[model samples]
Target: MIEKTISGQDALPNISDAERIFAELLTGLAAAQPGFPLAQLKTFVDQEFAQIKHVLHGISLLGQCPDSINAALICRGEKMSIAIMAGVLEARGHNVTVIDPVEKLLAVGHYLESTVDIAESTRRIAASRIPADHMVLMAGFTAGNEKGELVVLGRNGSDYSAAVLAACLRADCCEIWTDVDGVYTCDPRQVPDARLLKSMSYQEAMELSYFGAKVLHPRTITPIAQFQIPCLIKNTGNPQAPGTLIGASRDEDELPVKGISNLNNMAMFSVSGPGMKGMVGMAARVFAAMSRARISVVLITQSSSEYSISFCVPQSDCVRAERAMQEEFYLELKKAYWSRWR
Candidate 1:
């Protein structure tokens, strides 16, 4: 039996719609009288189930590609998230293995108990099972930590997980299926005429990801870059579309700027004073304090005179970061070496 438990306090409402409806039925029956037409309720539930099943079957029938491709499918949610995809591939006589990422990591003795040797573990697993013609589907992001505790890879983590798997398996390419066609010149919602990019280098992709592009996580490109693997971002609803290819720089000349990315709700902090001029290690000291406080600096700009430095961080972290700076530079402030401004 699969044992699933809610974690966070606000996670109790994460049940499926079917489960919620069944609960309503139980509550209604409990409040009703002895002759409350139990048979009618059962018939209604059966009809609803049949209708839902038919709708799901219809959706599953939409994509029926005859050609089979070997891949490591790392999905967003639980197994049900990729049920239709699995069905379509299986129908085409493709052998697929639905792997539990956490369990697979444990099986290879990589994570959860000791140091994570991702490369070694993946090499062993890839060499052992799943024939050349078969595809492997896995739940992404969720894994075991060094102490055997559950860990998630944070935002856009599924994309990162997919890249990791592809690098380890030495796959020809990795693809990310999303709602949009591919990475756009700007967010379509913000810029109505935002154009799609056909291709970009891995360095550009990483920079865009860090600067607020949501297509892939910043860490997703690290392993893939090490192996010089190429990644494609495609839309699940538009499988035939040629999506953006992220890899090494092509020999052909291209535009200087491929896209624009932005993040909002940020506060800027500046450090400036006459004493800061020509001071060695002053910038390092300022940043080290933020690092110790676990504050992420979004952007940094230093004056050419070297007397002032300015940086931006999320508004949520500004207050904590300020306090950390005060504590770290108390001596400097007392000596009138620098002043902090927000």
Candidate 2:
């Protein structure tokens, strides 16, 4: 029997949890299925895998990541779950590091000796400056308003955390592992034959994310776009599936509609005024302050006249934004353009 070797750079990139599982799968096959040609043997899953290889067909990572390359995982506090994932990646000969976002988050979590609140956990996960080539983030749940005082990334923060981390690191791309096979044009849960998109532009994915396809985090596209990072939404549950790709690089074969992503518990705000009208850098100043406060902008729209820019954000950030506007733009706040949809 011919022996196939997987090592060094070739083995490094495929060391993620999903890919490691694929290795375990191969081992099982070699043991139980015996006498098969193991050398030159390849693992091919659904049509999705074929598409995945095709997408990366031309793109190269300089040279595959070295076998001993490292990755960093950030979580709200120290988590066994993130630690476990880090271990999985490391075993495949990768160097992995796990960082608890901040001291406060960890101190409270450590006191619990077991569990902690999700929002404080996510807020504490701002990406680190130290580099690890690859970054992974996790979400304990889907959504939340922190202590009823701030809107946290909520349910899908893991995905957002990944994107945010990628943006921070300026990595080549981010790969998010979820349960679903990939991004479907329609909810496969609703429609059995829903078409899967091979690739989608950031704008298309963002629009779909707003609708309901859960592959990309609804709140992550902005950070991703800011740096033009590419993301692959693949299944951790089914690593063989062909996952969808999101980013600007899919310049070819772009589609008008990609997938549908949705947000529940969303709030909208509308503002209009002559003060807002003919305003110089008014919207920029508003958003800048929100960014400074670590408030995330969810959705936004402006009047045809450019008089105002109204945006939706986590319910938690609303009050902070309002108070900031009041204190900084008191005259504008008194006669400010403002309205909302809860």
Candidate 3:
């Protein structure tokens, strides 16, 4: 909604869609738990909706949605859902405490493109205000930036958040529940014959995720791997199924390849010329330019002759990648010493 508003695809300052969705959610919650405090939930939702409206109004005035505003909006959604979940748990006779991770647990930096400050987060978790006896229902994805602004971890960040929390708390295992049962030989939807993987090493899971497997966020494996914490990918719909386990050791399988993953909408760029041969730091310079542009290179290969280097990046980054290369190698291109192709 924020994106659409900023792009002029949505009416400025309009939050009716968010309003209707939350209303339905609250209505369902009320129906599900008649004894629950629906009034309190409604009040909380109203407060959030008002704040969202204020942000939308600011966006209208600025004609843009800044990272701060975007992150705040994302935090609000997570906050509301966590609150609702807490209410449901409370209604079930559990003593639930809704903890905002930003306020009580995780501390992050880089605002919208946030990464957890592990030391700070661990310190906060150690000094946590939540009672140990209560069922702690903490908000995921959202964290407080260094400036105390509400910020979000990146996409599929709840998994990353869980992993970070597991490592910080030194939990025995981290379970990531999703729609699918677990990791498979390939995406089961595309490859009907794909076999369900029982277990895989953290390295294997990370590689698969980096190459486009959707079971876990690529960064999710980092903290767990570092801590040697086991991770389980389970199906929410089928709890009885023994989902894939990811740990320090790999399970022996007869098949050599554990899974097959593929990335789509890729744009390949090639740099080739006689001037490229035996060029010291040439490859380094090529990647350094990409680093400066914050564009991730998915794959790279060099010719045996060392005359050319080819690399792939997401197609969406083609324009920026091209611009960065042009700027970085302006002299070489101008001198006709090397050529670039996409």
List TM-scores for all candidates, in order: 0.70, 0.45, 0.92
Rank the candidate models, highest TM-score first: 3, 1, 2
What is the per-residue lDDT of model 3 for residues 1-342, given as tens digits with 9 covering 90 to 100? Answer: 777767656553357777788889888878988677789999999998888878776787678987877888877777888888888888888887665677654565556667787777887777766576787667788778666778788888788888888887788899999999999889888998999999999999999999989889888899999999999999999999899999998866546678889998999999898988888887788799998997889998999999899999899999999999999989889998785555
> On residues 1-342, what C-alpha lDDT tens digit does candidate 2 reach at each position?
001111212322432444456456556655655443333233332232344334333223333322111111112222434544554455455555455433322212111111223335434544344355644534331222222221233446556656655665567988888888778888887778888788888888877776556666556677678788888889898998888888785546656545554566655656665666677776687688777765667767788887656777767667886666566566666654433212
What is the model-wide C-alpha lDDT for candidate 3?
Answer: 0.83
lDDT (0 to 1) per candidate: 0.66, 0.54, 0.83
Task: Point out where model 2 deviates above 4 Å.
Answer: 1-175, 186-193, 201-213, 218-232, 246-256, 306-309, 333-342
Judged by TM-score, which candidate is best?
Answer: 3
Off by over 4 Å in 1: 1-94, 103-117, 251-253
Q: Compared with the true structure, what per-residue lDDT tens digits does model 1 show for residues 102-188?
A: 555432222211222466558656656777777887666655444444445555657767877887788899888898899888999
Q: Tell me how far the alpha carbon of residue 241 in candidate 2 is from the true structure, in angstroms, after superposition.
A: 2.9
**Candidate 3 lDDT for residue 64:** 93
Candidate 3 lands at a TM-score of: 0.92
Candidate 3's C-alpha runs over 4 A off are 9-14, 104-109
For candidate 1, the TM-score is 0.70
Q: Which of the two candidates, 2 or 3, achieves a greater lDDT against the reference?
A: 3
State each model's C-alpha RMSD to the native.
12.6, 17.6, 2.2
